[model samples]
Target chain A: MSTTTLSKATLSHLDWLEAEAIHIMREVAGQCANPVLLFSGGKDSICMLRVAEKAFRPGRFPFPLMHIDTGHNYKEVTDFRDKRAAELGERLIVRSVEESMARGTVVLKSADESRNKHQSVTLLEAIEEFGFDACIGGARRDEEKARAKERICSFRDEFGQWDPKNQRPELWSLYNARAFKGENIRVFPISNWTEIDVWQYIEREKLELPSIYFAHTRPVVRKAGGMLPVTEITPAKPGDVVEDVLVRFRTVGDITCTAPVESAADTVAKIIEETATTTITERGATRLDDQTSEASMEQRKKEGYF
Target chain B: MSAIENIPAQGNAVDNGLLRFLTCGSVDDGKSTLIGRLLFDTKTILADTLHAIERTSQKRGMEAVDLSLLTDGLQAEREQGITIDVAYRYFTTGTRKYIIADAPGHEQYTRNMVTAASTANLAIILIDARKGVLTQTRRHSYLAHLVNIPHVVVAVNKMDLVDYSQERFEQIKADYLAFAAKLGIDDVRFIPMSALNGDMVVERGERLAWYDGPTLLDILETAPPAHTERAEKFRFPVQYVCRPQDSANPELHDYRGFMGRVESGELAAGDAVTVLPSGLETRVKAIELYGEKLPRATSEQSVTILLEDEIDISRGDMIVKTSELPNVAKQIDAMLCWLSETPLDPRRKYVVRHTTRESKAMLAGIEYRMDINTMERQPAEKLAMNDIARVSLKLAQPLFTDPYVDSRGTGAFIVIDESSNNTVGAGMIL
Candidate 1:
């Protein structure tokens, strides 16, 4: 109930990052007519939710919260997504890949194939169905090479395609979020944030996240030199040895492709320490699918994968 | 693993602050190589990434590792062996963090360079020592000044090819200084180094004993923070209006707060402010930052402001101190950089988005297009892509704005083609 005067003011990198993110969020809210925050219950999206709160706190968000469920995700993440949205009393719209498969829009090569890339079809369908003009995502520029080439407010064509070579020139903080009727813009507020920054922010803000991020004993199978989580959608293959190891997921994607690393860091502070010392990038060490092709991420992005 | 121990902790280094810089020069001036070396020397490049780059280098028929491959991440860039867009790379030394915007040096990609320079605190202009100063170097320098980058470091790269001659370095430096002086650039520094050899980039090499200057990393670590020269003036552009009517929290029933990030200066409780375009005056009751009330808020802090009296205010409204008001007008003259491939048509109506306001604007007249290479002005009827020209525009509504030379946050805007919805140009108010 008491106010304290801030003296000797010097803004830290985190403060600058937070302000920049909030500003971008506000720009999206002001420009886009039908906008939605893509919530996946990940650390980046959690930080985004916090920024949204700061940007528009005493009032409801201008748009709803939506999720494109891959149906192969961990229960912990989806549960956290629902609970967080409920607590905030915001509208959460969920569209699943299963629906796309049922509608014959997504055809997989095999039953065991990962549904990660096919989520783009479901996401596009959802965009068309709801007429979302803009989708605010938690993608970071440092996450991948293609993402680094993207503008903060990336524009998509009528078919929801990304053209890296031909992008709008984003100067200063003045982002051009204008789009045609069918065209939508994918806004990345935290594009400048590095992985270390995210963890540092998590530690500073004390944000709640899914428990799978911390080190825990979980059943897993060693495949392609990465530990693939043993979920119902991703069961162990023949002659695959399952083991219970102390591990944690640096990034959470579909269970079929997401991998975990061996670590004993169970808390946010410890995770920060681990992240600082680790030599491998989060995707390089944990993603079973990204290592297969060098241009896969870019190709998927062009097809409208967030 | 000892090398890993040598790396500084992220907590201490990042806390010192972050520096955003851009590297630009003519094509093949080793801009990517310089950035790659910085990352490599800082140990910020992961081992997996290094191995991948090495494999890629071998496949490209190179005997040694091609460090430039570390950047040039896109498939087209790998195949064409040229950087076509701006790529951002991050690294950290034990004392400071850096965000390097590696911009393409080709003349066609000048828009990309402008984009990078917009947010850069400093610029490292790389020049091949063999070719002292080319037109592209001058063009980049002009662009850097156009965006008001605080510091400019002229790095004469490929020093090994020129035998690391201090005479050549001094000659290049003198020529650059003369050119920069003409552009009114005061804070300019020069360094000679070989990005390919990792000399004078991160560590001071014995080969450069003749040249006594701080290494590139040292200079970056010691340079003063940016935007400290301008006099402080509060300019808060209302980005959104917050009014929470949730019954669960009774305290927020009648709350109406104007949300925005302070673009410059500071705002405190009880400070009298004026809303622009509307010309309504009020006093600041309190500043709220995410559920907590603060006595004051400084520049770059996103907070909600509660007014002592409720008034009709919405997005695109500027709130500033009553004594300090920006220029409010519908007709203005400015310099614009055309970004789209389509030429600028004087008869076309475009949308100009400035701060939080959007208005239909039409080009009134084309004064002249400046030749980036020679700094000569030539009368032009139409502006092609990547052309920098001085022009006059008439807006449908008055915009509260300032000259870019005074306040960058309040003076810049973008031109959008309404039909295609593509951002076609960037304009700086004169």
Candidate 2:
């Protein structure tokens, strides 16, 4: 028999990824005391929601749905977020950074600064408020450098920080979710998923998502070679020329920081096709806050940002 | 170039989706480096990660950032420029996403590879272009076949070291093809590429003009997902028991539910299922998840089921569809890959964890030790670390299982050393 013909018995790559993800999701629900699905209204989180539906559907979810609102989120996304959560009949809990700031727990460098890094403090507070032992996140390993180094059931300190150097050894499918009081585990269900996998699963599930994912004509100003969305919170500079461009957000985040990529691919199929050929990384194209090394994802995750 | 998708889109349907893959090869064959290249060239490696790799390489007095250093995390592995443990890396393309278990190639690390590829849908066995096929290659290929990874990609790496010769590539490909045929590996793809210099990896190479096929990532993105919907039986191993704590909620307080995810196949609410090891039979009354009831529970879903009759069931008990009961046996023969530094003791008893069932297993006998390089099985009295041999185990109790070749989730098990609690070896049922 031909060499090519002999390999047909092997399981395809995606089947393995799906099975593992499903297994991890079930493990979290089985082991943890109070687990909550952390939704960001992004494609990855949307994929997590679908996986959860497959994992624990036909019945109410074992845990509630939650989001750590930055108070700088896109209006379109947060609006859709409320609607989607209501439609699913699942509890949607929002712990706002604005409330944390008011309560003197979150201090900013400036009044108009991006609240991306400060999200950690608010998240830790929310975890404490709900006494959630496991916070199920949509963080994928393929997303960033720090995330790549994390365990699927990443253990967090009582302070809600991640120490990459002191992680537990995760071998085979045996994950250690053991922790003491005041400590919690940050469980990433789609840690194995890629950007393309998220989009494909999104298309497959016909999951209702925020409109920012698809390409649409919007008013924007070019800054640092990225199309910065024209928002009142993040106004354009004097020299920056505002223009109309058909663009889509590769990743959705706090509106003050998330940028858009130039594209006319208005549908999921188009997005999938466009994603295949794009050379720039997902965070590189859209997340303006991640451009610097000082405020990196690792630092944010270390400070308790999911 | 963007319109070159050739694989069927499986994840486009609600019922069909993602595939998981693993990679195995010899230590110096660039398995870790190849995975790093795939992640980097695919743009899955973030800029910050590249910067970190660059810094670490500089500290190690290397002019070029060694891609293998990204996976060789242990201090010992870094000093040796080899993989000592199974390092997992994740990435995605438009067509499919991948999670790779880059298992070490050393003889002692064979058990690590088994653990890595146990759940893998596909396996990529890297063969060095200059070295052609080595014993480690055969051993890894055999293990991949044993674990039943449905797809195998024979990536002929370091073609640059071989002058990009088509004859050399074809020769190696033919050798692999011949051996793979004997092992029942039907879906194998041979690709020629240089992992270090980026030849036919993410982009098509200018060198090797004779080759006409998709890049490694391209092939990966378009490869078909393994279809296992036709599994003969359904199994659900209970993980927990749920009963609401609130006294006010009377409807939930008395609702005793057996919680677990279906390991394989599908089961309807009224379908009859047999409890294995105990041999008791019952019918499903309702499939519940949280507070809602479902008509059915498919494989991989975490749903709690209420049986029509309250037959005794708990964790470690197998709930299999009555129509498809597996072979229940007290003793099993299997191919074992030893992992521990301490050699196997014939008199010792260890805990054998198969699926959810944990039973005491004693070493009955070692049949033979495999010479991976020569594809020879030598009769052995004892097995040492990294030795692959067929062994017989006398179990304290019967286990419900299929052959490892038939089903991975239920057919294989791990031997945990009782004293140290270390996973010493993995076995595939024969």
Evaluated with TM-score, which candidate comes out highest?
A: 1
lDDT of 1 at B407: 79
- Once model 1 is optimally superposed onto the true structure by TM-score, how far is the C-alpha of residue A53 displaced, in angstroms? 1.2
Interface RMSD to the true structure, each candidate = 2.5, 6.8
- Predicted candidate 1 versus true structure: per-residue lDDT over A85-117, tens digit per residue: 999889999999999999999999999899999
Question: Where is model 1 more than 4 Å wrong at Cα?
Answer: A1-9, B1-14
Model no. 2, DockQ: 0.12
User: Which docking category, incorrect, acceptable, medium or high, applies to candidate 1?
Assistant: medium
Candidate 2 TM-score versus the reference:
0.72
User: DockQ (Cα-based) per candidate?
Assistant: 0.60, 0.12
Q: Model 2 chain A — which ten-residue stretch has the worst lDDT?
A: A1-10
TM-score of chain B of 1: 0.96
Count the clashes in each prediction.
1, 27
